[model samples]
Target: MSTAMSAAWPYPLLADMVLAVHFGVVLFVIGGLVLVFVGNRLATWPWVNALWFRMAHLVAIGVVAAQSWLGMVCPLTTLEAWLREQAGEASHDQSFVAYWLQRLMFFTAPEWVFAVAYTAFGLLVVLAWWRYPPRVARSRG
Candidate 1:
């Protein structure tokens, strides 16, 4: 791939629409946690892999958060926008992060809201990490 293409590569897109669906999943998992905290029965289903799923969700969110803070564009975001363009849909040309994330994710949080939310989300991931730590031992075996 050329530099332009490489800059927007979709390791994330190819890896689970990682730019989009993962965001959706993270939101869902977090929302589910809130429900569980509120004593929702759905949060207590026997077949639900809540702990493992939330751990994965939180980790993915952490990676995305780190990338944003470091000023690195997400490959998945690039690829998805490219795919949308190919499909004749609109894409963000250029703008502040606040504008696009708000439009794409339907989030209207203020700048401080985003900062606080990210910090809280990061804390959640840390807590989950303490509880789970990713099960690498089992996976390697």
Candidate 2:
């Protein structure tokens, strides 16, 4: 939605926007790793190894793993739930931890499973960094 239109909309739309942004984050974390490995294999897709893109992808997953290990709720999830509540929508009946796993991937499991999965994926990202280093972008003066 346009910013002007969104501004005029009611509360529920904010919650929807938050959910969409959260899903985009999830896609980036997953797809970034896929491209890191696959893109390096092909002569194409060199942009995947742009230094800033690699760094952002790594940091993104790193934060996810850290949040899981620390048992902290993601701010996006918190904000979405609060917005939903304000809109008189049912946030969820599940516990805080459960909602974290459920909201993103649509699957439910022990939180430790997500912690381990994120940490393991993070290690893979680090390995990719080591094995296929990102190229620094050059600027034309």
**lDDT to native, each model:** 0.53, 0.83
lDDT of 1 at 138: 43
lDDT of 2 by residue, 19-44 (tens): 77888899999999999899999959
Per-prediction TM-score: 0.47, 0.82
What is the per-residue lDDT of model 1 for residues 19-58, given as tens digits with 9 covering 90 to 100?
A: 4464665566567445433433454543233556555667
Error of 2 at 52 (Å): 0.4
Backbone atom clashes (below 3 Å) for every candidate: 0, 0
For model 2, which pairs clash? none
Residue 85 deviation, candidate 1, in Å? 2.0
lDDT of 2: 0.83
User: For model 1, what is the error of residue 71's alpha carbon versus the real structure, in angstroms, after optimal superposition?
Assistant: 1.7
Candidate 2's TM-score reads 0.82
Error of 2 at 80 (Å): 0.4
Q: State each model's C-alpha RMSD to the native.
A: 8.6, 6.3
